[model samples]
Target: MNIILAIILLVILPYVGFWKLFEKAGRPGWEGIVPLYNAYVMIKLCGRPTWWFILVLIPGLNILVFIGILVDFVKSYGKFSLLDHILAVALPFIYLPKWGFDKNTKYIGASATAPFREKYKIALKKTATREWADAIIFAVIAATLIRTLFIEAYVIPSASMESSLLIGDYLFVSKVNYGARLPMTPVAFPFAHHTMPLIGTKAYWDGVELPYYRLPGLSDIKKGDVVVFNYPMDADSPLYRPVDKRENYIKRCQGTPGDTLSVVDAQVFINGKAAPTPPHGEMSYTVQSDGSEINPQLINDLHLEDLAPGINNTFTVNTTLASVNALKGYSNIKSIVPTLSPKGMEDPLYPVYPVKFPNYKITPNFPKFTWNLDNYGPIIVPKKGWTVKLDSLTFPVYGRAIEIYEGNKVQVQGTDILINGKKADSYTFKMNYYFMMGDNRHNSEDSRFWGFVPEDHIVGKALFIWMSMDDNASFLNKIRWSRLFNIIH
Candidate 1:
């Protein structure tokens, strides 16, 4: 008797729940949970050609079929108007029941078709309609809140900010360190964010100025700070905005508003003051994976090279002139703040100033890029009203200005001001972004080329390392026990 009851519940409940779905599809109620038969009825109600579901398994054409399913499903049931149809497609679960249970008296059919399915077939359903509805809403809400208010997860794919952050290191970025942005683009169906992509053109159709609003969070930004922000170039990827709550980056903030920054001999000097290097723990003379000895300076496998005019060429130093030139270019060592140099300012035109070299190279087994990191800078971060003539330009050194608006839309143009196809004398800024780099130096590709990360793009500061694993390591070395619970300062 128990087995029979279990079978009955399993077979009977879905039909009861999906009876409304059958009616919405213009089919008889009993056809609701009849797998193959209901599929046949759905094809009939939507007026689809036979075997369309089979074609839906095809890669590219599946998208087109899904679209057709949405369109036909809505039109066959007159419960939803045109706008409702659009909203339902973006987020279907919201209108599923309406299509199911609504008593709207219209169901269109061609050539006198009957409403009921002929037979029942068993099939596995992925998720319940109710669960789907809740999941969609939950994901969107959680993504938004985590993007703005709490912590966000990000994976590092490249070695740009290496040493400090490895390629496989996944991070939880905190948004509370700064602040979050309120959701402005509101037309998304509870779960469907598809329409957001096609919404490239702003909805300025209403003719009212949509004033930008910012939800205040952290009070200040500090230099040498490691931060995560949105990628300014690709705002439309997942989050619709360049600086998003969705995508994040981990970098050290080298410049802030109103602060002059310059790098001299690879040393970063902010606002005419020298930036302090993080304290290096004791050095270990262990051999690395590549058979290179891992010494104190090799804690992160840092390579230091001298790019000085007369220094790198010394025979006793055992350095290559080409490597030195590469160091000069990579480190921007010709100028005190090489990264901040304006574009077209490549030649060493500035008067050479004497800089004292640290004795890091004296240590045997020290990497070649050490001297590059030893250099300091003296430059300033741009403020709202500050103006300066840019003679030369440098990539990754300068941060561009951007204006973020209500619709997850953004406009980016910088101080090398261009206006209406002409260059302007001075430019104004809506918000400021900073350039960040990793201590790994040579391995990290950062603001040095892509551009400044705006305040709105900032995701959060990294607080700690909770879990870590290196797939290449042995079982004993798999877990990064020393890094576990380590505070990210």
Candidate 2:
């Protein structure tokens, strides 16, 4: 409704202002009411060639051309002040009506001899401060629009996707791949994610929240695509954040909507078939070595992260496939084996069943389901309009989705489930959900730790690494030259 009102004001106010302006310029006042023809009249008023009309139809380029036209339009009225030009571009509806209807303002004929730079200089000479302010305001508006709708730069802060995406790697995420989500929390500090940078307070207000909506994009999110999204469980904290304002997380999409996902012996399977893994995916392994301590040079050469020393000189290391293969060729290494969680053994898992409220105690029946990180279920990812029976066994899996993510008051009564105080035998999911896991499989705190990520939380697709840096390296060696500008898989 707010968006509709905004659009109406934008259209009606400009139309009325332009209609009056048309009369002052000796053109028919009704011409402004006619949609595309008004633009043609506007182009003629700016003294530009008719071919320039086609340039205004383009997206990004049109903004510059339109701004130029508006500047010239204001100058054509003999108002050459920097403030007037800024107001014309930034608040066109308000300024246009003022300039058009006010008896004092007059239309000075377009100066064909004066160059654009000379006219801009005449307008800006006395109002340097206003000119600078206008430039900053326009730059911020343009950057925010591009960031929200097209592509955004992101920095990797954790080692969860190590080997593939290193700490301090700067990425350009493409919103066009998975579609750009409209701002749910519209009022936020520009460039700040969840919290204020220096003060560390909440960066956005929930006063004017909007429903989740996305603009159509180039493609749908497919399996194996690296994705960035808001952390679903971040809202469990005392300071609640809206969907778009929650902490951002980057991970590989392991399961798509409607897919049944499971992990057996640390291997993922989607719909009864072994899922394809990323070429650079990694996991932890226990490596037994001779009594002597391993050489630090060898560790550096293989780019291995030594987790900790195990019993009898065995070291648990987080390493990539190439590092593991290189370590296997050493004679002194006794054995190397993957650290896999045993089946039929229950461990702390996500979406802890029957825990209705946030930060509540785990129900006693949670142990009935024997699922671990490595040996998870053939559980289904929720799809829009897909129905699933609500039972004790399935309640734990979908409870968070139904109650928290989808916004309902869900309760499990004796052999019955109630949503919003009414009995519900099944639930047709309102939004699709995705399963996300990091490329560094064993070390990641991802979907396995929390739960499924709803479509509303998705941000964009990882596009490329514009810059990469290693903090642990010396100053001269910090920048990773090879990874710079590399396309993200």
Candidate 3:
């Protein structure tokens, strides 16, 4: 259906407009019907370099080239109004056919005015308000196009990625890294994400939703990459959000498709081997210091935060490896060890499939598998086309993926598993899934609290920190000079 529409818009409509416009410009009307050659002829008519046709092959760059061609083409017809240029680029089918078929519209050629702006000087100089409105409108359109299809600015709002990314850090997320997702909900308030600020109302309307689609990207996601994705569970809220409009979250990709992920004593393991941790990844530690208190300057120098005094000269701190190692050098500090949950401790953890879907339960043979934030999974991340045998015990692990994420009605009747009302023992995944965790292990409520991140929920890759400010610091000291323009690893 979409393919047919594209053909009509890009080929049929353009062919019709170009055919009439070509006759007005004294070019052979049939040349406008030729696919690639039509663009070449149009470029030639506009007095642009013929080599620009090469740029039209590139995705994002092609939009700019087409806009330039259309603007010049309209100018060739002596239509120099800002509205004319907008219509030439936005609705060339309507603008071109009207100008070409209408007897009054004449081809003034390129030398009518030295500058395009000079041709509309009288009308443009008439009102400052009109000029300001045109500038703002053009600026919004250009910025919106660039932001939706290329790169967008984002700011860290939570300490989830602390130590690697801090609160108040401004980042540029690259859409081309994992491919830019076409907006599922296209109509929305300008520059607002999820909700409109202050008003706390939805920024977008659910009407006219499009299917999930992505353009070609530079590369696929790799392990240890800091990725931004929409919160998958946000749809569970009372006021549902479209896939792309869910809360944006940034975390490190710990497990890719098909990899089994687990955490033992707060240490992540993938496929039975220990996964590589980020250099600045951190965890909460219980530090036992001597009766004498540690100097506030030393604590400040180590960049430690959330320092809480524990009983008997013990202190709990969330810090990076370098800071932990530096603290260990002090003879007064007895030990610094990870704050691990006791083994066999089964408190509520992620997915909570059994609770969410009461029909499913752990098989007696599995010894009621207990998991915690510190000691989690061994669960396999679902891969596209991978089939898994479903049973009582395995259901809790993959139930959400099969039912909610994959959009299937799943249930357990007696000992048999029913998917979409069919008695099936196995199911194949439709899309690849990822497991994301923050660098601040204990502090982050990440995949361990939720399940896998579906492919459609992916947003972009965090490229770099353009600015960093400390919220707690004075105005003069707020800017973090060293972190400015720092590349996000």
Candidate 4:
């Protein structure tokens, strides 16, 4: 049976059973299925204002609403006190039905709450063990609903976004924040968010089954919001790392759609104006023997084989900062090949190091390459209805279309794609890519590395930080009082 249908059966069966029991007590039987109307019937049975339901919507105070109802239920049955309160709350199904159907007690027009202390007291009551046993299951359902549809817990991992979000920061991620994605994978394991038996399976790709369609969340991605998303390479894989077990990273949005973005002298310029940066953060650069290059520090170790001694040069690198910094005092700037330390060397199996250089001069105040993080494109992002054709003439304008080879045989082409020899029409297009970067310029592996991050890979914008901690030096570091309550720009 479908799990939702099973849950409906489990819930409605008892309410119907209680309705029949209410009929035996000379009350309206239809009250059982009317939701809040049933609450009104119980209120009338216990003698209280029906307007009290309004109090149930207040945060934190709603616990008192249920507790007050349970107290009233016990009192209606001529039962009161702490132990009765426990049964009314901890095992409410037994007490609610007992008060409704117990023939031994005659209906007295008893007030549930009297102004004095005596009126609020709960009386002792006894009911069947069956209701007591079902308490755990019912409570589980209530808790599960709140977690699945309202809010959930997530832990933050990595320092991609330091200062704002830290490693080991626990967060209450709202599932409803982006209205719920239909639960396509129904049998998820408890607390893990992984589907059991069919673990690692995805709903659909490109446009297959596409089992889930989520309603839009709070708002679209805003600049500077920390967001968590599925890695573009593989959506089926969990975002969290096992060691931290939160989504893999928390990064600030540096660019949004339709923005003409460029980085000049380590200061990001959006549409020909300098972007405001945080008061305190580092501006990273690529340094040569002569001077420094101002740019977004490329944190990925890139070793393309075109510019080294070996016929096949491969870069096993830690990061790649472009030499795009203009010499502030000098008109002409130049870069010599950098000498690597012992630790910077790579082995034959994993041939890293000695980055290949193109025959291009390092010029001051000029955009170096077409798509470095700091010197990226004038290419406008394609929105819906924008058509694209992949031919040699138009391919370069979109992006480079190069064929990668394995053992002198072409395996893949530009934009991480391949052309099948047998079928010339087998070329496939991937999703549209967007540029993403970190606020902390020196440290971030973003669109600059493996190319642009697809727009579909965007999760949601990071909202406000409810809490903050200083975990840089030690666990006991003092809180950053200045940063507290500060809005993420």
Model 1: residues with Cα > 4 Å off, grouped in runs: 1-136, 183-213, 233-247, 280-378, 387-418, 421-423
Per-residue lDDT of 333 in model 2:
90
* Per-model TM-score on C-alpha atoms: 0.48, 0.80, 0.80, 0.44
TM-score for predicted model 2 compared with the true structure: 0.80
User: Which candidate model has the greater TM-score, 2 or 4?
Assistant: 2
**Backbone Cα, N, C clashes tallied per candidate:** 52, 0, 0, 14
Candidate 4 regions with alpha-carbon error over 4 angstroms: 1-153, 168-184, 194-210, 236-248, 258-275, 278-281, 285-370, 392-434, 451-458, 467-487
lDDT of 2 by residue, 1-489 (tens): 655655555677877888888888899999988976777788888677889789887655566667777777777787777777777766777888887899988766663225644665654355668768768877876787789888999999987898889899999999877777878877687778788888988888666577788978788899999999999888777757788988899999999999999999889999999998777778878899897777788888988756578788888887887888998998889889987667865653223322122112235544256667678787899999999997767777888888889998987666667899999989999999999989887778888767899999999999999999889999999999999999988
Expressed as tens digits, the lDDT of each residue in 1-489 for candidate 4 is 344553443355547644754565468788766766666666666667877777665433455465566466555555544466566565445554665566765444344646422544332233556357447545654665565555655555654554345455555555454454433344333455432245664222211112334555666656555665545333324432111112334465556655556655345676677766644332333223233322223221121111222212222212223312222233322332222222212221212212111102223322233334334444443323345553332333333211210011122233222234331312233333355666544445554343344444444444444555656546566464555444444
Q: Please give the TM-score that candidate 1 achieves against the real structure.
A: 0.48
> Which has the better lDDT: candidate 1, or candidate 3?
3
Candidate 2 differs from the real structure by a C-alpha RMSD in angstroms, to one decimal, of: 4.8
Q: Residue 75: error of model 2 in Å? A: 8.4
- Candidate 4 overall lDDT versus native: 0.44
Report the C-alpha displacement of residue 219, candidate 3, in angstroms. 2.2
